[model samples]
Target: MVATRAQLIWIPSSGVGHLVSAVEIAKLLVERDDRLSITLLVLNPPRASKSNPFAELLASVSSSTASAAKSQIRFQELPYEDDPSGLGAKSNMSLAERHKPQVRAAVAELTRALDSPPLAGFIIDMFCTPMIDVANEFGVPSYMFFTCSAAFLGFMFHVLALQDDEGKDLSEFKDSDAKLDIPTLVNPLPAKVFPTVVLDEEHRVWFLGAARRFRETKGIVINSFEKLEPNALKSLLGDDKIPPVYPVGPILNLEVTGRSDKSSEILSWLDAQPSSSVVFLCFGSVGSFHDDQVNQIAHGLEKSGHRFLLSLRRPPPTGMLRAYPEEYENLAKVLPEGFLERTSERGKVIGWAPQVEVLAHPSVGGFVTHCGWNSTLESLWFGVPIAAWPLYAEQQFNAFMMVVEHGMAVEVKMDYRNDLGMETKEIVDSEVIEKAVQKLMKADGHDEKKEKVRQMSERSREALAEGDSSHLAIGRFIGDVFKNIP
Candidate 1:
């Protein structure tokens, strides 16, 4: 008599960042436990096309994973139809809501298939909480794969409490001086740095609803390690109402593939520079700047007098909801005149960056980032200090945690928000950028901070080692799935 393997279905958000993290965890689960087989139900963007990068990414992942043993990890593209009423373009949540029927059908077919593995559970992205209903219909447990910091998770719970438990209106805090005493952080959270979702009425309602649904899941699997976020993880674990929390990460996909030509150029340039001398600036996939802001940054790099590698992307056209950053055809139009020539000795500017490889380079000492959670973990994993420049979503909160709560980063502009129109409420001037870069790259000014990050990097690795915090947490999660198997 052979034992049956437990089957899990993963529904990740359409964004590359979220999908990549989900895929990494799915791979981790299958590799750690042979009794588990996972299927990722890939979601296509509303207006997906042949040239769509999301489709290409899914193809690349599927192709790469085709060689895995026994095909334990699989990718299934969920059928998507454009919303005729144009509601899908409104927000990611709305688009996910429209996919519930497809999800239900997919889950039902998987469960009913002959010789199918026993259904263990459904693992969903944070935005796909509506699919919890589909899980409930099948009488199987569901879990959320939170792609952000544990601190951000705690913050969302706090936001929900303020709205429901205390009947407090969250709108009043926008741009105000009010401070929130969230249990996740050591310091009080200033209202100004709140994630844009909490401030916007529609997004706030959607997020609060998601937070409420989070309690219905069996547990949450966060992509952050224990030592780096002890306070938040402890706070979450101690809470009785929230689902059981598992901190099994710093789960980064460190493999750098694709873009060989551009990556080779970037690496060759870094090879010639002095060790610990370059400041690498890269915002996340959708992060781009206005022409004026790009000019300021170029000037800033020139004045900072440090070697640099800048990944500059063109902003999406206005009113395009699902647009991505495009590489500039000619850099001279956006950058200052003679700027590239003047700094040619010490700087190299490119479009798309191989971020993980760049950070792993010895010549890279500091990072100027958009402070996305994935980027944050990557920087810490490589022991690179950060200059936080948050653009949108929950990034502002992430930046605050790095610079204010943890002392791992210097502030470039914590409150910067670039929305659909590529319009910014505030522009970080060249002087501010110069000073932040200087502070981040100075030899003696932040030795303590630098050492702290280096030590944290070691702890991050240790947490994932056998018998350590993250490893044990993954074991616990797998055990729970087995226990729940009927």
Candidate 2:
């Protein structure tokens, strides 16, 4: 029987990245199936930015679509009446503990709001697996949305499966200089390039909890494509510990909404440059530098003699990860003496640039990026190679995946750690930054690398089109819901 209507609720972990990624896949899901509707039930997170990612998603969902199916998408933010987990006040609670009460509250509220058409399934990021049990209370199937690459997900599951006698835990491996034998990876991963979670005991425990909880979900959805990580996806499926895995990704390449008015100067500057001559620098949302480091980066850009646009901000506040908008300051005060004047014609320094517009421009030949997954995919989508400078979290691992696994980027600093809002032991020298910029921008050594990335760019676009692997995987997932979700 044809289903009259079906609703799916997707709960992303509390962050701009998680929310935006969920919105991407949820939009595609509804577009492919007219019988489907999705509701993004967001829990309140602590900090807010002027360029909030959720606002961008909301705008796109409301206005940018050319299809009639866009109306099937719905959005709601559930306000927690009682602080069952005290998530409102910032504490050191694990992510699982932090999301439980809010997830239950959202579920309860949504249940009460619906009259006839009930939920089909709940889609959640791996960080919010605590919400899976809430789905059981309503007899709804829960699915896992793995936001990271398949290689990282496979390595994590391998670590979680290892027993006391099998090998030492990830924390013990931290002190050693050994490369892990993750069977899923094409090359062994060095301990220095591992994600930040395994290095800390508390975060390691939290990861283990999330990893083990995957087995309880109905299925898993990864934000990656088949040709991108074939072997790792194969390994993920071969393992009995994980549920049926679906590869549906390169999702962050969707249309960006809510770009600020400040981007016009940057885009106009880029358009005036010769095609494939300018390089753009955009670290992740929170990636910024200390004054000395910013000085070094400025010196480097001046020496490169290439047209460039850089998106930079002041450092984040104490005990916070995301940065808030700062009062406008003089560029000369933060950079080296005569730096702005020396490169004034070739370089434009803005407080924040519209990253999607800059990346899409024909003049942008390369990117100097912090290899957050979103930035990495965006560069690939635009066929712009990167000089990878990873700061924290799984970003170091992402850098490895880009340089070693995909050969799409050059490595600048895969092991740089300067995110405690403090001074670093040693600053990356001006010459080092200059060399990497030149290599990615105008060097003859990167032609083959650029060609390969261009090929992958075609693949990235094809994966989301009709009759492609990612599109088919999403279709199959919807079919599974129709078959199993009662």
Candidate 3:
């Protein structure tokens, strides 16, 4: 008798960040269990072009997997169809909901194929929860792959319970001085740090609906290690109504591939800097600033008198939605006049940084980040303390957690939201930026936040080792998957 291979279907949201995380988790799953295989149902949103980062990354992964002699991982591109509902292209939630029919068709075909292995379960992205109905049709269990922090997950559940069970209107809390008593955070969560979507009526409804659907899943696989978020994970596991929680992560794809000459140049520049002297300022792919804000940052860096590398980007053209920042044609146009000349010996401004490479460098002492969970984890992994400057999404919450809950970061501005079309009234002036950067890059090398980050860095690696927290969580998750397979 031969061992039966179980197949799992992964449906990640259409964003490049989400896809990268899902791919990393899928790779981890297959490498751990030879009897398991994964097929990713790739989604392409409207107006996605070859230049899109998601497409480029998918092509790269496919090419690498194709070269392997016996690869268990495969990619299945879903047929593209414009969302009949005009709202689908507006947000990730609407876009995922529009793919329900396509997902159903793909699962039906996969189940019908004679050569396909036994279907195990559906692992859907946090935004793609609408596909849970299709999993039910096939009599398979569905699990959610949350790409954010465990504390944020707890916040979502709390929001759902507050709205449904307690009939509390969350919008009233906006702009108020009230502090929320969420179980995940040791301190009360301030109203200002609430995600912007929660305040908007339309987006809030959609987000809460997704949170409600999360309860239908068998479990949630969070991309965070246990030691990094013990209090939040403990609160989640203690809740009986919530499904089983899996904390198996720091699932980073550290391989440096398809490096451009610009990346090499950036690395070489870091090599010449003094040890623990450079402060790196690189936001996420979509993070950018207006000319005025850029000027403020420039003055701040100049006044700090610190060695710096700034990854500045131009915002997308007018009327373009869901677009990444573009490279500026000339740095002189947006930068402060003669600013580059003044800081010539101490600073370098560039676009499209190789973030992991820069963080891994020995000379980088601190990070001024957008507080995206992936960037936060990378900073922790490299033992570099962060100046938390959140831009959008759940980043504000992540910043709050790091600065207030974990005491591992210096707060630049936790509640900043760069919403498109809105005036950025709360500009972080040069003075605040200068003070934050100085505090973050203090030369004492004995800052408590830095020490805490260094300690978490070691524990993050330990969690993934044999018999540790993350490793055991992975084992338990795989065991549960096998148990559910008929």
Please state the error at residue 424 of candidate 2 in Å.
Answer: 5.3
Per-candidate clash tally: 0, 0, 0
Best by lDDT: 1
lDDT of 2 at 123: 90
For candidate 2, the lDDT comes to 0.76
Model 1 Cα lDDT, one tens digit per residue, 187-270: 999987898778877667788988999999999999998899999999999999999998999888887556588899999999
Q: List model 2 lDDT by residue over 441-478, tens digit each.
A: 75574498898889889999999888999989999898
Report the lDDT tens digits of candidate 3 across residue range 58-122: 89777766554146888898876675433222366666667778888887888799988889999
Report the alpha-carbon TM-score of model 1 versus the true structure: 0.96
**Deviation of model 1 at 458, angstroms:** 0.4
- The predicted structure with the larger lDDT, 1 or 2, is 1
Q: Which residue pairs in candidate 2 have backbone atoms (N, alpha carbon, C) closer than 3 angstroms, thus clashing?
A: none
